[model samples]
Target: MVAAAEVVACNEDLITLILLRLPVKSLLRFKCVSKKWLCLISTPNFSSRHRRLASASILLSQIPGLISHLSLNCSSSEKPFSSLDFIDDSAGVKLLQSINGLALGCSFHKLGKPRSYYVCNPSTRQFLTLPPPNAEGHDSFATVLGVYLAFDPSKSPHYQVVCVRNCSLSAAHDRYQIQIYPSETRTWRLCGSPFASPSDIMFETGVLWNGAIHWISPTGATLCFNINQEHLGSMPSPPSDEHWSKRRFRYFGESGGHLHLVEIYGPSTTQFQVFELERDYSRWICKYQIDISPIVDAFPEMVRDYLHPHHHDSLFYAFVLLFVQETEEGSSLLLHIPGKLISYNLRNKSFKEICDSGPKSTKTNTALHIGCFHAHQFIETLASV
Candidate 1:
């Protein structure tokens, strides 16, 4: 009996080590193996190690409540869509942004009024519905500039949810309202205004980097809000040869903890230009200008028949720039072209098609049917909301 117990203890230690390296999704399932195993996997130390080893995926959501996840590694075997079970079907859930494994979701009522906001950890299937902000006078027209999630459960159990509201104060002027909700306090309060003048914050392409949330204004300036300090700042955007009004196909994103700007232009709409902000955010440096002519040349039939000659004029209505992945293999850009997803590798100058099979069939879909979809960088974590 003594010898058997010693062997069991040794096996348990070996199992724990092996499980620590697995992804959070697998660990969540393994928790049902035994009570002892559940306790081990539920530890803070185990959760931290699991997060470090896990890779980030891309979460894609379509209008009218369709959510899916795609692996960032571009694994073909991965399912195109993994349904989010935590969200209720009746509730109209719209994902705002994701940070440190926690996603901020805005749920609207039947009449389209601003409802409650939920911070959810999709991997762990845990979520917390935050108390609604004080919206006494603010109505549905109050533009939600952006919803930022400031949570890292690994460091501390507490988290914060910030909502940037831009409303019309006058015909020519706008008011910026900053609302903050801390987990510890469980209450929402108006922090303060972050902008000096009436500025239109681009919420669709907001990127969180360097402990701040950034958005590009119509004037070609990057608006920044420090999450920790709750202060606002502005930085210059990338230089443009054409007028600011003429340059429309620009997106703000982050890669390798650095902010990047992607501008797609040219007559054929095959020119891809990427810029990286300096460490001090003073100026922008042109990283690369990839000519996608090789890709277009490869598929001459598709380019000649399907590709629009003047796509650059209405790029947003046609194509969406998905997440950018910088890996050991190479840097690649994921782009949503109508019904299909294409990946362009910067190193090899090659383009590969990605599969997008969701709950409904996409074989006969078109650009109009695909509509507007949101994609975010998603990392699996055992963090609680």
Candidate 2:
């Protein structure tokens, strides 16, 4: 048998073919093997093959509720999918941010600095540590969340992660400008001046969707941070409900190409509202409203004191919410077979989910930890196409 190390070290042409044929997880691990391997995997050819193989695996599995969280390189020769658990990542991973297929998680950090977000490919399990953006001597934004990460595979495969900067005393809708971290240059750059945004965000309530980042501003509008232009725009408003509060933007998730929002009703009776972005948002008239509700009766055992509003724009329904008068119980998760992380399609009213993290997985607190990412300039073609 040919030695894998020799195959990687000898020929560039064969390395591409071999690595492409290897399980995605293995390439993730090999990212640490050497700089050369890292460069090779980041290339366009390898990404395309990986996507092709990943698509094939998805088609084979018909389960639609689960999303692919990890795709490992298990064998030298990749083939059909198999029932395998490459890595058992726990919810405690502290997923601070996720964009494209990369997630930025936080672990305990010493030196008294708060834990920070690390760019990682959950499927490949390949991660790169990013230091905190320097805000020294300058006041920090009123609110902050990791937002928008976009990459152009054709152009150096360099990816950019957008961080919302809500400056104090700014009037431009661009008050929330973006700070971008480029993988190739390994540097951070602040985009154009602050776009218009509310002075306050109640709390950081935002999620990445359709190649852009979104947050619920205290001003009661869904604020969208365009990843391509780095501009700030408002999404369609919520359905008219006197009792509704935009502060509840915790469950932001992209599913079936549509952006879904979750709302928690803090009242005598508990209510969970799910909303999808307007299918035709050409004029931003699209809106999300209550889809599912009043679970207090059906899920009496699920006690959740969702008093504190967090970013609630996700599809995760497994976490038990505590009611003042009830006890807590485990909730169920959506299970899709062989899921792959795909972008949300606002026009199609669907977001793609992968085949990892089966329904049996435990509930997660990432709804609050989600950061943001900008859309790749390439995807901008969708607007015209």
Candidate 3:
């Protein structure tokens, strides 16, 4: 009995060491093996260690009903795409944002009907549907601009869902209102508004960084809401030569634990300038200026046949900058051009095409078709809502 007890203790230690190196998805499944394994994986220290070793993946959601997952650490050829079958097909679900391994999704319904919101862990297939926000009378879908999920399961088991809406259209009568629903309380309450007057917050472009949510305003300024402080703040956006009144094509993202903004410019939209926010949140510095001429040069025949004729001056206007994926190997920019998705490496100046089975334009004559697709950085975790 003494020798058997010694062997069991030795096995448990070895098992824990092996499990710590594995991914969260595998650990979640292994939890069902025994009660001991379940308790070990559920510990806070084990969760943090697993998160640190996990690599971020990209979650792509296509209109109507399709969701694909791609790993950022591996090349396009090496990683196989996996579809998310757990999400209900009939819900007409649209992914809003992903944070701390939980994705916030909303299911659309007919007009005047309340939309259903869900917080789900794609890896674990665990989900929680949030109760409807207490909005009286004005229950139309148009009233709500955006719903963002703000939760870090590492800190606490509870999560918060924030809803931004135009109060004028609702019964509130305020220009804009911020409502927060805490999972612990299971109730919705109005929070403080960030903007002084009526201003359109780019909720779709909002990126969570440095314990706060950042969004680009129409007037070339960044509006921030600190998750820890629950306060509003503003920061100056990158200085641009273009007029502030004009719509600027830009995206907010994070790479290597730092916030970055990618601004697309030039006649053909071939020039991509990347700016990284300083750690102090003081100013932005130019990081890389990538030229897509090589990619354009690689496919000369297609460019000349399709692009030159339609866009006489701007031959590369079909290409749109999506987001930047930074890894230990290097950083690459993801671009969408017509039916293809291309990844351009900033370090070696190499371009690789990512196989996408999403929707494409049937018309061969058109240079590009802006279809309905969304992509975001995802980290797999066992965090519950």
Candidate 4:
């Protein structure tokens, strides 16, 4: 082994190429192998190259307690790692959003103290605190609706946090405003004048895609905020009939630089279509047709027959669409079930269990709804927080 190492180490070019292909965890350990390896991997250029080529893994968080890492590319039995443990547990810190490899965390407000926002790289266990939004007298009454992280490592290492808040003009009229915190500036600034957005829209669940943050409302209204131009705009969602007016989208997220939306029109159905937003915001194209009837046949527990009559809104009440992997080879879906995470290939229709949640499922125990869990794509990087 020593002789083999020496032979491979003879050429720095070959050594660098091999190291770049290794996982971030393994590369960190390899750094201690020799000073040469440490110096090579520690360089900014090497880190950037590794980050660009790294495959993304989904980080599943079930609020105050559990956080599981699910890798779609690698078929390993390695246990999930707790990425948010570095933050103080007592602070009631909850992960709001994660982009690239950095996570945006929000801590609950104490008695007199204001809430806190943190940008952290879970891989490095490094974090940075963000300044509070500058709100004067009347604006002080505004409540934060959602906080989102926009970090595209492929574009730049620096990140930006977009905070959407609701401003009340009266008991009848409520307007919304946006505040942005760029890592380069380290201060919060209002993005644009307050505007009236669609009612019943979940602003807090904005998905960053194609240089913009997009939010799809239950009423089928879609809004996007461009980070570069600092402009708010609207986009088109997938076409729907009267039966789909309620939306009932299973997932709306970005993966592999593409925006995807999954809306299950009817209640007790096992089939759905995945839509991809065009780069030009022209229209949503049907990317994949998903039919999980075979999975339900195999895992009878996934059926929603157990739900009470009142709660029987959908057969997917127990299934959560965690992550979707779009690759050149094919596409696959990662779904969160009761006690395990199942990966179903869209191309071949094959499925397998990727991660198990032990005796008591963390999400099932904590979340009133079985589908309630936060999932973010994590790409391992040596980038600084």
Candidate 5:
């Protein structure tokens, strides 16, 4: 109890230990306290250690152009922080993918310039613009399918970008090729030879898990690319219904080191099953049967009024799953409705409104569709590109 100043001066090592445990937002504010404190927190060693122990938050977007962060441990009254002000041109930015703590964003074409990509850390409000992929001649014939990001901070501080293109030469032909850009090299290189793929595969909505980028095909096939090995492989998909040709995938993502897939076979039903991939990549096991009957009962607007027995897809456009959050208490499903965001607990079967839909500018006029809403995990980190 001598004095606060004396205590901090006496135990600089203890102060460093405490700073690493605080959230990044608090650390950012504390930097102005003293010059010595600022120097200690800005070191690469401290940033790496803080990132390794930071808790993850969910970054959700109903439309690709808008993004917001949802803290799992926060109360319902705490509205999710929604803004892209860190970007100079926020209106034209679309977040394509997120891995670990870095977000992969694409800036739409403006003026006479072509589209540009950025790898950013939302926590630190820092970003690095990336050069265009080196797909020279294929630009005219090939359609840019998607750009995916691969990063694992626990293994290395660097990240890689994977650009996929649909190079189908003819109607009968279905071909695809991939180019990878590593941060260390800062140049895009063709990973392997062109490969064949199903025409129905949605490569744009891929997710990174277990050191690989995974794409789930609607035709009951899963495609994967090993970033480290540069090998193309396939994984087992969730059980499919042969009669149901138009199966809708509600979610395909990973949380807490677990990969999950959700499919709603019947459009009018409020019941669905969530499947988790086994660690060894053998099979998908049915982990949870989610019944939103109670939530739907409370909010009747979730079901459309087009009454018809033959029309089995009346409730298909009611809601979209934004995130599947895993925690020590239990897991919860974050969903988006017409104008609200709600969380439904998987274990207790209880539902509550986490927050209202964000600002009007962020809202889109398009009808709800599969893959319309996305939620990616954003772990706080100071790692720069």
Candidate 6:
């Protein structure tokens, strides 16, 4: 076999072929191959290509799987996830940004590792690298924690990105700090807000809809920030969960053309309660206690495969994605189990694993948190295991 170092110096096509076959671990090491390869892997164009491949969506593969997916795009797979797609794992994810298929990451071996680098489709065998957002004095404290990359579908193809930071609340400061980084400008603009701070971890378990990014605050406050409008505010709160261990950001999304949040019982981690915010300021309630676990009583043999296993690694924590799905009777949502890219139907209350048993070479786990912008794109932590 050709040495990895020699492979990097080869022509682009050969390098791309080798990358497509290697797993995440191998890709990380390949970064040292050469400066050019490093630069190539870090570009925005490569990210878009990578997204298309790993999702391996057939544009038309009739996998009885994702059948439970409540996505509005549930029809034929003919259309790609739209050309311009921006994906980030959590609202609190500062260092990672995925836009138009490219994932940008902040790399710092020293003090604060701000969002500086970007990773393309490690699976697509392409990538691009951009300079860090800023090389300022506060580079130690300024962090790109949460990201929102969006393209306007109503108008011509257009996209924007927002990188937020929570600075310290000193005597001179009362609210948290936020920063906006638009791809069109390639610069960071500082904006002080009514709420935000460096120490706070804005819960990712909120909703992103109508041009705003939402989050569940640590103290149970429903928080939201508008990326286009550049404003911070709060949404209405629901009743408390009796169980505290499960007291994390549950799933929040827009369904049937309405804003919604799903609250599940903690500890039990089985039952899910749905809350929909209405125009008049009232909530629509729908609750379903799902033991999607492998408990035989919960699911029969026919649908057993839909229930996948989380890695046995004790260090890893698993969070289930429960979003609103559309149903024939009314409207519904489904739960997306990590590792297994399948969406569990809330209507039938059944799960369908996308059974494309092809070898997948992904940059990160499939179970990343869900967002509103597009499919297979969500906010995730950058600190690798």
lDDT string for model 3 (113-188, tens) is 5677788887677778777665655663456776778777667777888777666743444576678888888888
Task: Give candidate 3's TM-score.
Answer: 0.83
Q: Model 5, range 1-385, lDDT digits (tens) per residue?
A: 5697788776988898999988777888888988988999988889888887876667766554777666655634333235444767644777777777788887766665567778887767788877767665655213678888888877888889998886666759878889888999998888899899877788888878888889877777778998999999989868867787765787888888889889887667788988999988998999899988888878776777456646655544478888888877789998877656788998888988764444353245324454556777777777787
| 5 or 6, greater by TM-score | 5
The RMSD (Cα, Å) of candidate 2 is 11.7
What TM-score goes with each of the models? 0.84, 0.54, 0.83, 0.85, 0.87, 0.52
In model 2, which range of ten residues has the least summed lDDT? Answer: 376-385
Per-residue lDDT over 1-385 for candidate 4, one digit per residue giving the tens place of the 0 to 100 score: 9999879879899999989988777887899999988999999899999987877677777655467776665546454257476776456777777777788887755666567778887777778877667664443423778888887776787888888887665646778889988888888888889899878778878888888888988888888899899999899967665754487877888877789999776657787888898898898898888888888788777666544555656444457787787767778888876656788998888998774442246535533245456777777778877
Better candidate by TM-score, 1 or 2: 1
Per-residue accuracy of model 6 over 1-385 as CA lDDT, tens digit each: 5697666657697777666554344555777877876776655455334433442221111121111112333443222222112323222122233333334333334344343444443223243343344424346334445544454323323345555543433546634556665555656667654364323446433345667776665456566677767778766666666656334556656543467666555333344566666654454454544555542233232122223335222222233453454434554343334444445555565555545322231114443343311333321111110
lDDT tens digits by residue: candidate 2, 88-195: 332223444433344444443345435445565645444676656655334442245444455434343457767765554534443555688777667678777755
In model 5, residue pairs whose N, Cα or C atoms come closer than 3 Å (at least 3 residues apart or on different chains), thus clashing, are none
CA shift at 318, candidate 1, in angstroms? 5.7
Predicted model with the maximum TM-score: 5
**Number of backbone collisions per candidate:** 0, 65, 0, 0, 0, 38
Model 1 alpha-carbon miss at residue 375, Å: 1.9
**What residue runs in model 2 are displaced by over 4 Å at the alpha carbon?**
1-22, 26-43, 55-93, 107-111, 122-126, 134-136, 139-147, 152-156, 166-177, 244-250, 264-273, 279-300, 303-385
lDDT of candidate model 1 versus the reference: 0.68
Among residues 3 or more apart in sequence or in different chains, the pairs in candidate 3 whose N, CA or C atoms overlap within 3 Å are none
The list of candidate 4 runs beyond 4 A from truth reads 1-15, 18-39, 77-80, 108-113, 138-142, 169-171, 306-317, 355-368
Alpha carbon deviation, residue 250, candidate 6 (Å): 3.7
